[model samples]
Target chain A: MKENYDIVIIGGGPAGLAAAVSAYDNGAKNILILEREPRLGGILNQCIHNGFGLTRFKESLSGPEYAYRFIKEVEARDIDVLLNTTVLSLEDNKTITAINSEYGVFSITPKAVILSMGCRERSRGALNIPGSRPAGIYSAGTAQKYVNIKGYLPGKRVVILGSGDIGLIMARRMTLEGAKVLAVCEIMPYSSGLRRNIEQCLNDFNIPLYLNHTITKIEGTSRVTGVVVSKVDENKQPIEGTEMHFDCDTVLFSVGLIPENELTKGAGIEQSRNTRGAVVYQNRETMIDGIFACGNVLQVHDLVDFVSEESEIAGACAANYVLNGRQEHNPISCINGDNISYVLPQKIDKNIPGNVKLFFRVRNTFKHCKIVVESNGVVLQEKKKLICVPGEMETVILSSDVIAKAEGDIVVRLEC
Target chain B: MNKQLTCIECPMGCLIEVEVENGAVKSVKGNTCLRGKMYAENEVICPLRVVTSTVKTVSGKMVSVKTDKPVRKSEIFEVMKKINSLTLDRNVVIGDVILANIDRDANLVATQNYND
Candidate 1:
């Protein structure tokens, strides 16, 4: 391994692979991708379901197939990659400390670094469901890895806890594999998963989706035997006298995903309270110069197609930072307005050229609403939508002319 | 016959109402796009879906595979049975056909490269 390089991307998932390829294509020849997995594809290896790459490729592809497109691109570009290598630390000075079986403790000082470590599913402990430490309990993603990668079924009868995409997909998967799916309970009234998944994965299989319900208590010892499902009130507190019982062996938790930002935090980078990831600019560069983040590490994207698009921006910007040096940044804060959960590229550099795409999600479901972007009481952009749900992310573009005329912090909100 | 279906063509998940008369789709409503209209029509007449799953290699490793095209939804389990029973010992790359004519003209192809 080289002691110095132009760009070092952490994680070889779809994000990292696409970043590396984009960096190489944009003039940075010396680039390296460090993947902790034995292979290049990260989470995509275990995501065997189709419905990926719809926007980018304009064709529905499986996770591995979507990843293969970028992997093939990386191979064709002859980009360097180190599999089974875990990055130990990332310093503010753009230095990376990594370790692998081939090489012991080593360090590399790259001119620019791109973080694409992705996100992890919120496990049972995170959910704090009153349950026994049973053997049949597994996170939805873990169950996916078990069934899709290891070729082992987690259990025969399953009761998924949350209606996240992974849980919804597993509902169908376990059923197809000859397991009996009892129920999918979600505490929230609306599922965080896409509507398409709710239609295809759960509705198609005739799986019961109990909204406003949660597993109140888990009854099991060495293995899962059953769970008590309870209905929740508007405040999400379990109500009395509304208990349902299900006899199932496995309980899969698919609550939510948290961005893996250990290294980002270690680097002392500013973090976003909403995304739980690094606070980046329009170009995806973090507070620290030359250190950038994209993909799930930046924001948990609903589609891999957006992950690829965002990582490409990070990759290209990192290359520019390496070749042309740092450009002037006139900071413009983007405030989350009413009903807006969070907006990405938390801050934008006004000096950057071209239009800017601001991605965000609503706090709740709204019908026949208008998304408006405002700065200093002047409307920059506004668009009408038939419906807006927290499950689906929304984006609005701001032209350079409107950005140039901005006088104060920009705000994005719903104008119902 | 009147049927209600959700358009899976995109994330919008348009709740479509289809009017079928004598086993033919007469009308589709509530779809936001052309694709949703087509999807509703096809779903009413004959539904199709791309099946993706993992097949075991000789080395006991799992290699992901998918149908090259959408197959009849009714024959998904039959296609999966064919996929589950097949075992390959040869090296294969993405787009390589693992099983041909598994569902009509839809070939089961490898989604991930496996070398053993």
Candidate 2:
């Protein structure tokens, strides 16, 4: 390990690997990737399902296969990778404090740092589900790890809650593993999972999906025995006399994902109120001079392809900041208008002189919608879509000419 | 008879309606792309899907594997049975064929590496 390096990426997942490769390609020869796992492919190792890399590779690939493509590149370029190393903190001066079993506590002051610690699933405790603390409850991702990586069956009968992508995928995965999947319950009318997953994972398997319903109570003393599900009203409160019961041994929670940004917050970096990650510019550089962030650590992405694209921006910009001091650029704030939940690259540097892709998601489901980007009532760009859902992400590219025409904050809105 | 299906060829999940006469696809409508049209026709005739799963290794670890191509959707369970019954005799690397000619020339290959 060197005392000083050009760039240090905190995670070894798809984002970290891609960022390191991009940094190296951009002339940052001395770069290091810190991965807490024993291997390079982070969450992808356990994500054994296909449907990854559709946009980036132009082919549908399994999670591990998509990650291996980048892992091979990183190995070919002779990039430095430190596995089984956990970064404890990031200081304000770009110093990283990390530790591993092989090496004791140590700190490295890098010229630039990239934060790629991905997000974590929201557990049952976070959901506030009233239930006895049983042994059969596991997060969808945790169950995925056990079944796909450890070769262990977590349970025999499963009932998934919250209809997220991971939960929907696990519904099919658990079913294929010879487990009886009774039902999948969602509190909202619409599912947060992608349309393909809902159709393929759940619909194909004949597993009943109950929308506008939630788990009212978990009835298990030692292990999971059953759960009481009830339909919820418009306000999300369970309606009386609308309860249904299922006999299942396990309950899987797929409520949502929370970005792992404690280190970013502890370092006193500016955080986005919506993304809960570091507020970054179009180049993915955070408010801190050389600290950049991308991937799930920046914003939870629906596809790994988008993660790779965002990390490349972070990696390239981090390299530029290290080689040439932060270049002079004027900042233009990008705001989320009506129906828009959140917009990435919260601020764009107009002087960057190129096209910048801004990714965002809608707050709800809409049909026949026009996504428009405008500034000071002047439309910059518009795209028509047949349908837009909160589960899938949408991107809009802003050319330099359109950006230059902005006299005030740029607004991205959905015009119905 | 007519059937409605969502075209999963790409992210644009277009709702396609297929006209069937005596179990044969007569026409595929409402699809925006050529791939979607093909998907609707095949779905009505015989659907196929890529199956991914993990097999037990000799070292007591699991190695993820997937079909080289889509297999008959109706035979997914049968193919999974073939996959679940096998225990690797030796360690294999990614892209190594675990089972060949599985359900219509689809090879089951390793997607993950397990080092003992």
TM-score of 2: 0.97
**Cα lDDT, all candidates:** 0.92, 0.91
Summarize candidate 2's per-residue lDDT along A308-364 as a digit string, tens digits. Answer: 988998999999999998787689889999999999899998878799898999999
Show what share of the native A-B interface contacts model 1 retains. 0.71
User: Could you tell me which residue pairs clash in candidate 2?
Assistant: none
**Tens digits of per-residue lDDT for model 1, A223-338:** 99999999999999999999999998999999999999999999999999999999999999999999999999999999889999999999999999999999989999998999
Error of 1 at B26 (Å): 1.0
lDDT of 1: 0.92
DockQ of 1: 0.76
Candidate 2 accuracy as lDDT: 0.91
